[model samples]
Target: MSEKARMTTHKLFLLPDYEKEGEYLTKMHSVGWKLERVSGFSQHFVKCESENVVYKLDYAANNTNYPEYIKMFADYGWEHCGRVMGFDYFRRNADGLSEEEMEIFSDPQSKLDMMKRVILTRMTPLLIIFFMGILPNMYMIVVNSMNWDRSTLLFLAVLYLGVFALYVSIFIYCIRGFRKLKKKYTE
Candidate 1:
């Protein structure tokens, strides 16, 4: 028998919504790549015949009972594919399943709760770093620019400004995603 083709891809950064990330993996599965493992930003997939597979992601960074947590999903038909960066990846055949049946979250409130968990666990630290570290350093760099060469000052300023821009973009993206979810479900 021929060996299955395998490949690796870098996700680069976490998506604002886990559903979007899951949808991306589901799309890949529909095109014949089955997710096998995940390591940091790298996802490994093995080629297979194209089929309808539903992929779902759940963030459970602070889960104390990890096995029980996974067992709960497995009891409901979700096959745990992998976990990376506190995100658990699961998949199952989507044939003859309704959209709600394919979903891992039971209700709109659960989805909102998951988003809150993500915000607390991931975004909070990012906000802290942006406000406490990057902003302060940028201020210091500006106040002490005279001590450094012109080229060095320019490089530091540009670097910090780029990071600042990135942080702002991410914050906006996440807020919009959360608001959309809340409005779509609550309305």
Candidate 2:
């Protein structure tokens, strides 16, 4: 067979969605195979033939500059392969796995784990804002109350609100940026 026909290495670039990773692994397990997690750059690996298939998990890229990364990969001779859906339905259909195997792979535990990780990642910034901004504002309020100056208190309150609004706007903008990135990559 030609080299392309005999190609055994399959590189999977995983978007930073941990839930999706867990789901992919759970489905793969149903087929009597398991994925090994890797660090940095690539996230997982699967032994295919003479080489190990490298799977990169980057849930961060799901909503980041993934398109540019994909382009860079293409430039480096990596083919634009198919993507795995949240579950293994597409894989099962393509690989012709039996229904029994699919059921086994559809493990709830993996899905739950994936969900937890995704939620944690998404919430991290919000948690940071709450601690850094809201908590400080609370402290300021306490301090202002002790001083008992109405005008100073009002000014401080207004200033804090303005800062809070700015912080919220920035957060929203970042979220939009991620969504845009996702759209670009999917296209």
Candidate 3:
């Protein structure tokens, strides 16, 4: 806790992976840095004076009960850090805490429901854009191949194909993340 706060570069994940996010936060806490705030792709960390802090991230939608929801976690000893893209970040001091005591969600069913909310609220719109916008443009580029000259065609092809690849990657990521949560819970 020498300095106030510092910004460090972190690779942003488009799809939410709650467990992985917690792992990263736990790692940061282990090294003396704690999560201060999050905005878009940037995560702010501060030099913390405590160790063994466990973080929990959950897909809490932009709803009226958000404040009360946060209050509940606060009641449970989890500090309301901040929200990023409708996801709530919470952390509690795990001094002498066991593995089970570090958790926020008590059961797999609750965790599964949280992941479902993420898919319905966040990933669904991106999936729609991928299918509606990217797919149609891709189809046009492939079908009307001869109409465009080599140079113009090449540029559009590259641009649209890049978009297509990005969309596919995001879609796959969302699906895989959702399924992994589902499998972990149902088993």
User: Evaluated with lDDT, which candidate comes out highest?
Assistant: 1
Clashing pairs in 3: none
Where is the poorest 10-residue window by lDDT in model 1?
12-21
- Model 1 C-alpha lDDT versus the unseen true structure: 0.87
TM-score, candidate number 2: 0.31
For candidate 2, write residues 1-187 as lDDT tens digits.
5432211224442334433444654454454443443333343435332322222232221535657755655564333333443221112222444444333214545434444444466546566977787868768697768776888888878887787787677666655644554454445
Worst 10 residues of 3 by lDDT: 7-16
Pairs that clash in candidate 1: none
TM-score of 1: 0.90
Model 1 ranges with Cα > 4 A deviation: none
* Residue 105, candidate 1: alpha-carbon lDDT: 85
Give the TM-scores of the predictions, in the order they appear.
Answer: 0.90, 0.31, 0.88
Candidate 3 per-residue lDDT over residues 98-187, each given as its tens digit = 778788878888887788888888888877877788888889988998898999899998998888787778778878877877888889
lDDT by candidate, in order shown: 0.87, 0.46, 0.81
Better of 1 and 3 by TM-score: 1
Expressed as tens digits, the lDDT of each residue in 1-187 for candidate 1 is 9998999998765556677778888999999999989888888999989999999998877889999999999998999999877888999999999888799887888877887888888889888988999999999998999899999999999999999999898889888877886787677
Arranged by lDDT, best first: 1, 3, 2
**Which candidate has the top score in TM-score?**
1
